[model samples]
Target: MDDKAILHQYLRTRRDSLLAKLEGLSEYDVRRPLTPTGTNLLGLVKHVASVEFGYFGEVFGRPREFALPWFADDAEPDADMWAAPGETREQIMELHRLSAAHSDATIDELSLDAPGVVPWWPEERRRVTLHQILVHMCVETAHHLGHADILRELLDGRAGQGSGDPNLSQRTPEGWAVHRARIEAAAVEAEAAASAADTGS
Candidate 1:
């Protein structure tokens, strides 16, 4: 496949990987803040969708067919980073799906060198090509996918690209506990060695 097609595939794969992180999770788990920064599975999906719409739609002078309530002028800061009480999980998921389809169409229609502008970006760097946006979006999606992987693993100990993915070693809960303890022991040993060297004792 060509460069654009390859990048699009990577972007699409990460998008699916991210959504996979939410499968079998409850509303509370998917939306609950797992970090001090309020990072959550659903919130990450919403943020990525908003970003896709902006980069693929607005940046190219294409108008959106749907409204993003979280991005409205009256909305509070970081609104796109979360789902409001009334915003059902289905709605956010649908938005994420729709955003991907919309972005795919844009990528398919434009040439790699097709020029566009990002008004919100620095003036000197506002002008961009489809190739640049494709790379940018791929990196953006992959970055958030990393966060989703951690959040999902923390939520249920389910890890890897998806549920029961063979990419991860098969280990029982007891086995995993032993594995973790081994790593912990190594860390403690390293820290003690560092302290001793610092004190020259």
Candidate 2:
């Protein structure tokens, strides 16, 4: 495939993969932070949506009409990394879907060499080609999707990249449960040993 086609495919595939990891989860599960650092499934989705709109929509001058609540002028650049209470799961997902559509439209309408400006970048350089932006966005989307995959797995033991079927061993459910319990017991024992060592008890 050509460069534009390749980039578009990559971005869409990654975006869909991230969404798929969230399947069969309730809103609370999606929004729950899986890490001590506050990384969550729904939060990652929100982050990607904001960046998609910012890079593909705003940079191309087809800015989103709806205001982003977490966005601020003088705040940290990564403000989109977390979800505020006011933002619903449906709203975040819709924004991501809409942003993807808009980005796709812009890509369809513009040539690889079509010039656009990135306002937040260096002022001396006011323009970049559509091809450049597409590649960058593809990388960004793929990176976040990787994060989403890990977070989802940690939440419920689901694993794998993209929208592929989860692994299914021939072992029965009871066998799997026994194995899981053994692993959990081992982890608990290890933690207790480490704690005892630390305390000199």
**Top candidate when judged by TM-score against the true structure:** 1
Q: Over all chains combined, what TM-score does candidate 2 have?
A: 0.76
Query: Candidate 1 regions off by >4 Å?
Result: 163-166
Write down the TM-score of every candidate: 0.95, 0.76
Worst 10 residues of 1 by lDDT: 160-169
What is the per-residue lDDT of model 1 for residues 1-201, given as tens digits with 9 covering 90 to 100? Answer: 999889999999999999888899999999999999899999999999989999999999786887887788898898998878998899889999889988998999999999999998999999999999999999999999999999999999988774377888788889999999999999999999999999996
Q: Which regions of candidate 2 are displaced past 4 Å? A: 74-79, 124-126, 161-201
Candidate 2 structure quality by residue, lDDT tens digits, 30-111: 8888788888888899888888888888888889888776786666655577667787777888888998998999999999
Q: Give the Cα lDDT of each candidate.
A: 0.91, 0.83
lDDT of 1 at 121: 94
Model 1 sits at a Cα RMSD from the real structure of 1.4
